[model samples]
Target: MEWSKITSDKTALSLIAIVFVIFTIEGLFYASFLGEDGIINDVDYTIAEEDAQAHWDEYKAVTVNVDNLRQALDNGNLSLKLLDEDVSIIIFESDKADGYYRGYANGVAANQAEFSFGENAFSCYVDLGTHSYQIAPSWDIVDNKMIYAVYMTDYKKEEQRHEEYPIDPLTFEISNEDNLKHNISIEVFNPSSSLIFSEEYSISPGEVIVSPDISEFLGKHRYVVVLDGDYEFEESATVARSTGLGSSEKLYFNFINNSEYPMEVGIEVA
Candidate 1:
């Protein structure tokens, strides 16, 4: 072949390869934004929302079967029957100085663990690979001899398969339980750092404030709350998606002011 002809052929092949790569990258970039029903549009959002609502309804309709009449153990694996499954359990030792519990599930160390209090009662957090649960006793036990009324406050199955859809209209419910009025500032942003909603409210004692429905904006976003007062607040927020409908799936940031000091709390909601 002639030298010029060979060079021209190489140049043409290079141009075709560049075009192919550009189109492939563009296709993938758009594919990342596609919704569950293929195209990303208002109709897709409505269909996904309706399907999610149906799942929530079915989950709510199911009867919860809990066996709380089991005996408490001081330490070691405690097996309990829940929903017809032999779920392995581990009780947090109260004597730990750090207030952190470490234990094994199915012969493997738990991935995550924590402890919290509600109404002055103890709550346990355990993550066992595909399953995570928040368990608590019904009543305080004097010793390990008491029959602990254990119940699951939260349960998540990581192995369960499901279609991905963004749950829209994240509602923010703020309440001032203290005797004094509180000026609370609330803000929500999208993934692109754009301010989608922002509002400040003066909430009085025994008063509650609810934010407007947040539509369109989806994916992991930032939620922030600032209380304009010197008060010690406890953040009781859960980012977990609920199996119930409406406000049940909303990310709740409960601020319990017990002291006179200003504080701000921010969390990411998905």
Candidate 2:
């Protein structure tokens, strides 16, 4: 097996083929025989609008990504409808639901300001006096994340301001434009208020990020990030992780705190 003899094109082709064969065998062996489940990173899930609509029940089961819902309501009410792309998310405007309340957009606000959706699976409350037509999430566990059914109506015909950028599905990032000093604390909790994990950090200047891992835990989980020192702002997020074995994917959660300025954050899952 001299190196010089192996330099021929035929010999090189044979060596390449042998290496490919070994790799193929190794892949097959692990894929078929491995017992330890890990994260899924090998498969590509492609969604076609028409096909997705036909299988509405299956689409919502994929993951409870609220950003898609929020994005569907872009321009406050510009695209407020059942989107052709994501027909699984059902949202409609109705002055019904006897016990339900609406968020007042303007004029004389409504006296009522709370709603429980999906047969009490979730609940939400709105500030009745304010012109902001907003309702907080009830933190119901939906597909592994806290969820809220925000019933927004433009009573005063005022536009609902949209976020400047796209929401991230996994990461929480805050920009410190003024280089404000702040102490940040992040905590993870279950629906029952039981704490799962907590950590603290200090941001100097510029941008700071905290990424937490919730993939190890089973079912739905919540995360709260607070900035108590120097600045004062708090943010929270939710995640539903797949903890099954033999998976090729993993996930976690983290948070950040900013001073007086509003924090623009998104979640990202890798």
Candidate 3:
């Protein structure tokens, strides 16, 4: 017989063959037990599961509530637009409240607006009231908690009426508690609706001061202050000048807190 190649002994060759057969059988058993794709596939499946969990963790649910959609029925409209492909809401008054009708402004304001957006950023625009402007609020993802609150109303009714006055240096001061850390921005717009001055400040713990001389902008200017903090904020500001209105010193703006915080403003005409 042509002997199979073994080191020296036929008995040793038989034993080696037996050992090879046993190893082959063991390998087949292991593979068939977990199927053909066994350990590698299990590892891949675990990685996929982990990735899906991370994706769900990052996803956020955002809501926009236009409180007074009925106010825009006569003149304006309101809408919410999500950057994603699945959500939108157009607001109109479908139901009555107190004495007024209010609901989603569907066609008049926008097309499709919804309360659920599984993303971080979206736009909420309200074209309500008799004012000739746009009031669009933005949403952001802050601290892994993604909830945005918005209140829409008639601009003519909600805007604070400010008496025209004069001052040389426009002084601004913002105060917040120690637990708050954010930014506050101020913008000065002229009567022709041009941005004359704009500045942003980083606020951490205490009070900050911002003084600007807007001597060139004479009459009917706007001051828009925006704060992005997490705690109670108190805004104190005074225009340092002689109290009088001339052709070159009257600044008039309805201060609107359109930031991401609940703001309270106390204005004094000096």
Using lDDT as the measure, the top candidate is 1
Off by over 4 Å in 1: 1-77, 89-100, 110-115, 136-162, 167-270
What shift in Å separates residue 104 of candidate 1 from its native position after superposition? 2.2
**CA lDDT of each candidate?**
0.37, 0.31, 0.32
Q: Which of candidates 1 and 2 reaches a greater lDDT? A: 1
User: What tens digits encode model 2's per-residue C-alpha lDDT throughout 145-211?
Assistant: 4432223333333222112221123334444444455566766553323456777776666654545
Worst 10 residues of 3 by lDDT: 18-27
Which parts of model 2 are misplaced by more than 4 Å?
1-175, 207-209, 212-215, 230-260
Candidates in order, TM-scores: namely: 0.31, 0.28, 0.28
Model 1 scores what on Cα lDDT?
A: 0.37
Q: Is candidate 2 or candidate 3 better by TM-score?
A: 2
- Supply the global lDDT for candidate 3: 0.32
Full ranking by lDDT? 1, 3, 2
Error of 1 at 206 (Å): 24
Q: lDDT tens string, model 1, 10-96?
A: 344344221000001112112112222221111101112322222221111011112221123344445543322355655545434
RMSD of 3: 29.6
Q: Quick one: ranking by TM-score, best first?
A: 1, 2, 3
